[model samples]
Target: MLRTITIGSCVSVQGLLVGQMADGKVMVRVDEKTYVGYPIPSKRAA
Candidate 1:
């Protein structure tokens, strides 16, 4: 599934859901890189 995550107060990233971290963060892949950041709940989930 595709998800969005916030890396900072103003930075947000959108990509395919990779995996979840134990610290509550989620991993996302935009192209070839994977980023781990705090997840922002999607509208469907909220």
Candidate 2:
């Protein structure tokens, strides 16, 4: 599944969901690189 995460306070990235951290952070892979960050909440359409 594809997941979106925030790198810091300003940067957001979307990539394939790789794994989940024990601290609730998410790991994702974009291309050949992997990143760990807090997962952003998905917005529901009204």
Model 2 lDDT tens row, 1-36: 999999989999999999999999999999999999
Residue lDDT tens for model 1, 17-39 = 99998989999999999988998
Best by TM-score: 2
Q: List per-prediction Cα lDDT, in the order shown.
A: 0.90, 0.97
- TM-score, candidate 2, is 0.91
User: Can you give the lDDT of residue 22 in candidate 2?
Assistant: 96
Measured over all alpha carbons after superposition, the RMSD of each candidate to the real structure, in angstroms, is 2.1, 0.9
Task: Report the error of model 1 at residue 12, Å.
Answer: 0.3
Q: What's the TM-score of every candidate structure?
A: 0.84, 0.91
